[model samples]
Target: MPLYKTITPNSQTTVKIWKITESYQDLMAKVNLKPVALERVLGMKSELHQRGFLSVRHLLQEFGYTDSDLFYDENGKPHLKDGKHISITHSFNFSAVIVSDLIVGIDIEKQRDKIAVIANKFIDYEFDYLNKMEGDYVKKLTVIWCVKESLYKLFATPGLSFKQHCLVIPFTLLDAETVAWIDYEDKKHRYNIHFFEFEGFTCAYALV
Candidate 1:
């Protein structure tokens, strides 16, 4: 069994997630791939890839879907024949997924000191606001990374720069929640974002 927990925001639409940390056998069986593309990826990176697939599979089962029920669009986004939206993530030992009627994105990261080194890469837009944070720079940094990563998935575009295109509202590190946005020209698409850090892991969600 996958050792995991789940959360569901109070939404009119059916939106939910299955967070897991266990063997991915049952979840993998659901997709029932026939030695095709995604199925073949399983062998290349068993531990990493299996966890992700299992998370999505667990989600499909909740809605009476088998592994074969899931499909990918031309942009490599996962889609369901039932018209439900899905996003998935997997770290070394944990996996998560968010599914809803509208677009959704989920991300999980193992907390590490290395983030400080790459901070400049994603911290440009945030520097203006983060510099004002008196003490908890680490916590603030973690949230910003999560927020930008979630937006990357939400946009389904990896090439977008976090500092240039993604923006997180100014909030103290200790706050459990914050709002963020992605800008395309003058039009700003907003997202509802929330994050939590526990067991040396940081998890976040973005729904638009």
Candidate 2:
């Protein structure tokens, strides 16, 4: 099933990650997609994306759910039929989902050098503490990006700017945990951030 790793951040939340080592046919046969989902997969131009989409359904099955039990809101956020919160993310050769009684968000991103080139656009308060001259700069940048993205998905709020609205506290790679806050609409929200790395990719999850 290629269920690479599973983590229970709390009693109510479960995180499942899939390492895409199966053929498209292999994955497609493992899960049944609804008519709309079938059409969506058929419309994808890249086989990698199709596999990622199908792999998510497999994860759902692991949690005793199915494609029919999921739906998306007008904001494009995914929701569970039973009213639990759900967030999904897929990157090259990997996919992940998190289901929790509390609001949650998950993001998986491949480590790349390009993140350094555009770090200014999304980084504000963090720049002061980041040691750009260090060897782990790219890793730090990627973690910050993932943290902000997870928060974005959790909030699902429109017109939110990563640079202006979200802030991640500074921490070393060894910390594996940190804090983040979103200031918008005259409100302040905080989240507990936990992260880990595997095979040159970083995945971070946030919970309120």
Candidate 3:
């Protein structure tokens, strides 16, 4: 089991990351999936996605849960049957899960220059502080993207627009933490965002 790292952001919240170095068959043999999950995995056209899906089940096991203990809401957010909050993400070769007594979200994304091309789609006020000429521009963009993605997962609202509603406070790469807001429907919500990079990928999580 390549359980790469574990983080306890608070007494009630835990984050686990998995570095996927297993074959799809190997990962499949290690996890027992519910019928629906099994069918879903079998239907994935990309083997990488199948392995990512299976690796998440392995992370759930690390948190003392199983495939049967997880379900999705109408908005596609994951929930725990035991009433604990849960969020999951997987990118290329990495997968992660965050479980907390408080509402929480997590995301892992491969840092790529291509993300800058679509920055305008999900970025708004953040552009004021982002300097495209900066050496860490791509890294910073990846962090912001991860942070908003986490917020989206936690909010799970259908109309929340990342560009128009979600805003990440400015911070340097060294900060490793920042604040983000969801300004929507005449109300504002705040969340603490923490992020880190490993093996050319970024992982971030949000909590109230």
Q: Clash pairs of candidate 2?
A: none
Where is model 3 more than 4 Å wrong at Cα?
Answer: none
TM-score of model 1 vs. true structure: 0.82
TM-score (C-alpha) between model 3 and the true structure: 0.99
The lDDT of each candidate is 0.71, 0.95, 0.95
Cα deviation in Å at residue 156, candidate 1?
1.8
TM-score of each: 0.82, 0.98, 0.99
Which 10-residue window in model 2 sums to the lowest lDDT?
1-10
* lDDT score, candidate 3, position 173: 88
Please tell me which model should have the higher lDDT, number 1 or number 2.
2
Backbone clashes counted, model 1: 2
Residue 170 in model 2: lDDT:
87
Comparison by TM-score, 1 against 3, better one: 3
lDDT value, residue 108 of candidate 2? 96
- Find the candidate with the highest TM-score and give its number: 3
Tens digits of per-residue lDDT for model 3, 33-142: 99999999999999999999999999999999999999999999999999999999999999999999999989999999999999999998999999999999999999
Q: How much is 59 displaced in model 1, in angstroms?
A: 3.8
